[model samples]
Target: MRYWLYKSEPATWSWDQQKEKGAAGEEWTGVRNYQARNFMREMSVGDRGFFYHSNEGKEIVGIVEVVKEAHPDSTADDAKWECVDIKAVMDVPKPVSLEQVKAEPKLKDMVLVNNSRLSVQPVTEAEFAYVCELAGVDPEKAMKG
Candidate 1:
């Protein structure tokens, strides 16, 4: 499965709120950016992503799994907008802060490091794995749930 990252302002949507959604998950709506919307369209059920707290924490606090594929965004009136449903999979034992990511030589090419403005962006397998390692999580075990 592909890896991705989803950023949300903590005051608007925190990691705790996402975990409360349970297995049924919640629609990742309100995205208006065409590039971000397109990234969601490329996602599939079972794909994993980093649940990042933007603005406030500026960190990767947990992991999430795509429970539903791309579908019409319920919060939007435009037919061109779409999103996926994702559920919290596991918490990062040690939150990986943006500063940590930027400092890491191995993660210099990460989208989160280079294009911090994108709310939804793709994550390469290597980048995903390294971040998981940095967060003190076992990538294999975290994905099993």
Candidate 2:
């Protein structure tokens, strides 16, 4: 399965809130950037993603699974953008901070290192595994509120 990273502003939608939404998940909307929209369109069911808490925490706080494929964003008037449904899979015991990721030698070549501005980006299997290791949790564990 492919891996990816998706950032969310904590004040707007925190990890806790998403977990409360349960397995039904929520539409990944409001992605205005062309690059982010492209990534959304590429996502598929069962793909995993890093649930990043931007702004407040600025860290990779959890893991998510794409429950549905890309569809035209409902919030949009046109079909130019897309979104997917993602369920919370895991929560890092101690969030892997942006600073921590940058300091780790293993993550130097990771996309988050080279593209901090990307709201949504792809992640390699190796990088995903390393993050799970740092979080001290099994990558497959389901996250609950």
Candidate 3:
């Protein structure tokens, strides 16, 4: 399955709040950027994502599973906008800070390091695996459906 990184400000949507949503998950909405919207459209059910707490924590705090494919965002006025539903899978054993990612030689080419402002971004499998390793979460177990 494909992997992705989704960013949210802790003040707006914290990892704890996401976990509270339970299996029904919640629609990832309010993404106005075309690139970010496109990334959401590309997401499929069962895909994995890094739930990055931006602004406040600036770290990958947990894992989320795409439980629903992209659809018209309920929070939007325009039909062009779309979003996906994601459920919190588990918390990272150790949160991986942005500084830690930038300092890792193996993650030199990560999109997160290269483009810190993108709210939704694609992540390579290798990058995903390495992040899980750094977070002390088993990638194999995390990626399982």
lDDT of each: 0.94, 0.85, 0.95
Q: How would you encode candidate 3's per-residue C-alpha lDDT over 43-133 as one tens digit per residue?
A: 8899999999998989999999999999999999999999999999999989999999999999999989999999999999999999999
Q: How displaced is residue 22 in candidate 1, in Å?
A: 0.3
Q: Candidate 2 lDDT, tens digit per residue, 1-145?
A: 7899999999888899889878899888888889988888888888888899887878988889899889988898878888888888767787898899999999998888998888899998888888887878675453221
TM-score of each: 0.97, 0.92, 0.98
Considering only N, C-alpha and C atoms within 3 Å, which residue pairs clash in candidate 3?
none
RMSD of 3: 0.7
- Candidate 2 regions off by >4 Å? 139-145
Candidate 1 segments whose C-alpha is farther than 4 A from its true place: none
Write the residue-wise lDDT of candidate 1 on 1-145 in tens digits.
8999999999998999999999999999889999999999999899999999999989999999999999999999899999999999999999999999999999999999999999999999889999999999987776553
Model 3 misplaced regions, further than 4 Å? none
Task: Decide which is better by lDDT, 2 or 3.
Answer: 3
